[model samples]
Target chain A: MFAIEANGQKIEAKKGETILQTLTRAGINVPTICHMEGLLPSGTCRMCVVEVEGFGGLVPSCSHPVAEGMKIRTNTPEVMQTRKTIIDLLLSNHPDDCLYCARNGNCDLAKLAADNGVRDRTFHGERTHRPKDISSPAIIRDPDKCILCGKCVRMCEEIQGVSAIDFVNRGSKAYVGTAFNEGLNVSSCISCGQCILVCPTAALSEHKYIDEVLQALADPEMMVVVQHAPAVSVSIAEEFGFKPGTDFDGKMVAALRRVGFDRVFDTSFAADLTIMEEGSELVHRVQNNGPLPMFTSCSPGWVKFVEQFYPEFLPNVSTCKSPQQMMGAVIKSFFAEKENLDPKKIVSVSIMPCTAKKFECGRPEMGRDFVPDVDFVLTTRELAELFRITGVNPAAIEPEPPDNPFGERSSAGKLFGASGGVMEAAIRSAYFLLTGEELKEYKIQDLRGMKGSKELRVKIGDLEVGAAVVSSLGQARKLMDEIKAGRSDIHFIEVMTCPGGCINGGGQPIGADQEAIKARMNALYQIDRDDRLRVSHKNEWVQRLYTEFLGKPLGHKSHELLHTHYEKREVLL
Target chain B: MPTVKSVETILKEHPNAGRDHLIPILQEVQESEGFLSQESITKVGRALNLPSSKIFGVATFFNMFRFQPKGKYHVMVCRGTACHVKGSGKSLDMVTKTLKIQPGETSRDKLFSLEIVACMGACGLAPVVNINGQFYAKISPMKLQRIIEECREKEQTHANA
Candidate 1:
């Protein structure tokens, strides 16, 4: 390790670490993507160029190794010129598709291009044109919009350990894609959404559901009920000018009402209900020797990846629909029954931070009692737009309580937004259900926080239950791979698609740096702490739902409405 | 510890390659294996997922990937304004003929992949070639070829045993 003064800040960096890594670790982000932590530094973009005191020329900070006592100026005129030129060069080849581009409003390259004062894409040459690829069930790849930055390449090769795609050609003919231009859906590519998350352009983006949602909201005969995921509460506030990790549950409810949602429910309600079904299923599976390791199926990205790549492990996957879909089913069935609304006329909406939720809602398996469970899925961004277009300022809107039955939930439900939150919530309920007593230790502090990928063991009755938690779709791949290999000792696992879980979802407000993401994750925990009804099982509404309507967890009625099964995708690598 | 030239030296030697083609060369190197094993390729592929094979194909197919294994010594000659004005192309030709490989092709011994890149953006260092990550300025054709020979000899001695 060496210490250096960069931009008047003392930075301690590992030997051979680049200036960009040092600066990023020190929280001074110089725009970069081709320089992820583990990948080789390809200084082709020259975006991280910096001026040094002794060095006469501007150099790419991303490739330059840190040395002891190196005096570096990040914002010199020469450096700025180099950066501006680089941005101009990139913009020349970049397509002006921001308005229609899926990565619009969130792309790093677009943000930087805007920040760097790019007036035009100076080059008047013929634009690179390639067809859009939407064949995959989970992801879409548009070649014409690709900036050819290797972030996706590095993310796949170095991070996810799945070298499914790479830069295939060179010069004016260069492209980033699979071998022989194979469709991503057909290739060994796991639909982890990491590539989508890392792509600097709209070249890679999840299939969107904004149009379907818009149509549903416009249908006069339809009663569209929406539910926001737990993690969405922590992050949706960011879009409304609230800080990341702010628990804007009340404000989000207010915004949904203002957006003219017929009913704004909580997916946490279903997440709590998921615990009731999945937990009971786990106990049955364990006792019956059905599957040793029952993997959580909350993340559609992970589920699709597993179904496609590791089909042999299908038995291990929990059959319960993800809370988003589960809530959809319950909405159309249970809620529709209570309200005496025709099932066909009820359109259940989901406001999720997940791109895969769009895919999950369209699944043929989602229909129950002749009605498709969830009619429309909206990312947090789309929902925010609804509030905006409807002229509802979420910040100024008065906070109000949610509707009856599904409105009242627990802190256990709230924690479902963060990693390990689902596991913790489930254990809180399952342990008590088995022991026939409330857990005296209310704080299951063991399963909490942004610890990256973690594995913990706890004794539930005579059996030692091994549980693991992972955030970040890429990290989940590693955990899933280990579980598939039978090397993972965990009996149950929790996987959240985004890093820091829903608090830092892809559709959340833009510009959440690492610190902001961590802060929002903490806010979710604090929200859990402040709630009096912390355990999902003990929530009065949940108790009544079982005692008054559904009878018991995993019973015939609960299974019909709250619980569902997963279908095996026929694709194999 | 072999006699290695800097990245500048390799670039100076290869006359035909350019800045727009650097990514292709890097991609080719990575595709040959799973990753960019050499630091030169790593530096070259930074910000681009330049699998070496893809880079090589692009380099050769569109004139960019360096087919040569990067020697402990890489010598890149800048064909940018300063270097071009100072006869960087002539220096690159001299290195290429001496090494007996095209701009992107490596020697059979696997010691070096010659590459010609556009402006290092260092207009002051005309006719510049970075050898083994070190900058070598004011290099004529004769001087550039000698650096390649010296690096080749060092690799030969190391491999002889």
Candidate 2:
């Protein structure tokens, strides 16, 4: 450690650390736009400029290395003026439609501007009025509101490694665009919506289905049924000003009832249904000389990634539809029949902690009828806004149970919200099927946590079952490459497209750091530990459904509703 | 005339290239094909293990690489400080308006391509417009239009012959 004077206070700075890191370590609040922790500091935004004692010019604290006995003034008049000028210039070219923007009060740029006392635009010039891009089923891109901070650009490139969008043109005319300036649907975008999480403006966001969901709710002819994903129960609380790890599952069901949904169910039940189908499929593949190392297909982003880049692995992936899709089909088919209502008149809306779910529901193979499986998909953040507008506070309302039959889910289904949770759950159930005995203790620590890729091995009746859990498409690519390169030890893999799985999904609450994501993951694990029904096969209702309707896992009726196939995309558009 | 390598041939030479070789490969492709085609970009992206959008970003960052196919005669109107002072902006507007095209676009007849360059390091000939490496000094918008018509006439005569 070296001594440095930050804002006239003596502090010890770490070796080889930047001034920004030192200040951040000391709990100094320096506003930044383009400085991400893992990414290389481009210093293009000029928002973190600070005054150094010896330097003649203001330095970017993000990239500038800390020196011993160095005096750095973070909030000097000169630094303040420079930051204000930068903010003023950015605001001048901005769209000036804050009230209508998706990120109105939650914007990083607006927050920084407010902190720096930028009351009005000081400079005005010719602004680029680029058209909005809503071509993708999941995301919407408003080019005009983009401040060119390059956060979304770098996040899409460096983190996801998708490279669907990048900085096009040059200087002032420079904008983020796809190849040939084509719409996002024509690009290699997987509809992960990770870009929306990093954007400091309303330039990137998940496509809203709020209006359609409301219209369906208002219609007396339509019976609106809403379901919340497992991850949404844990993470949606963050959007409602609650603590990150708060479990709002019961309150969420109550809120959905208030939102005019005739039936509110838990997607966890469908997650349990997914495990039954997917786990059985894995077993059959292992026994019958079918495809080895069957990949999990719950995460829609991961499904698209495999379809686009690794088409050869289509046969290797489990044919089970995601929990959201399963819930949609089950609701419109089984639930509709139970209620003596027409499936066409029943509008199904799913609240997910994912942007990809919006795209997944509209897939050509998702539904039984001509219409989609799920009519509308809303992100957790979107649902939070609905709760806010309708005054349905989760804290204020009395907790209620979800609708019966599809509402009761095992703790194994709740674990589906986090990375490796699927593999852990599957292993528990797979062991029971192969050995006819429980594992005694359920928590598989090897498959838990926030690491991108993990590997674990277990034996079931002298048969070694090799399993790997991979989060993020980039990590999925790495593990797949390893497997293709003669690493045949892995017999099963669980892949979630977003980092840390659904807890940190693209459509979850914004401003969630690594700590917040870890908290949410731990909370899901806590729920699994506390709940008595920790295994999918142990769920009485699931067993009843299998016996009454589907017969057994991977049966004919199960194949029709719970399973689907994937095709290689021609242009990966 | 120099021998030009095909994009596939050029890509084959860089067998283990990654995203870093994107610019160098794009430069070679533009040099060979005169501009980056959508199909060629896709092919290059596959070779480099990068997305076409990222490749397009790299190709577009540099002003030299054009997106569309340039016509036989490339028309460059200088918008440098000296040229701007001499009212080259009006000439640029007039040329684009007449052709019903924007900067970096070809005429439907494939006779002329329009571009507004910053400077050609020739301030002595203020308000200069260059057509196929031949500089037309102190040219007005009307003069540029007449030059385009003459080029079209030459193409027509050559076709007849």
lDDT of 2 by residue, A533-555 (tens): 99988888888888777888988
Candidate with maximal TM-score = 2
Global lDDT of each candidate: 0.73, 0.88
DockQ of each model vs. true complex: 0.08, 0.66
What CA RMSD would you report for each candidate?
A: 13.0, 2.1
Highest DockQ: which candidate?
2
Those runs of model 2 whose alpha carbons end farther than 4 Å from true positions after fitting are B1-5, B13-21, B80-82, B108-111, B118-124, B149-161
What TM-score number comes out for model 2?
Answer: 0.96
Residues B13-90 of candidate 2: C-alpha lDDT, one tens digit per residue: 888888888888888888888788898999997887778887777777777788888889898999999999999988
Model 1 segments beyond 4 Å from truth?
A1-16, A21-29, A37-42, A52-58, A71-77, A97-107, A117-122, A134-140, A156-164, A178-192, A473-489, A567-573, B1-161
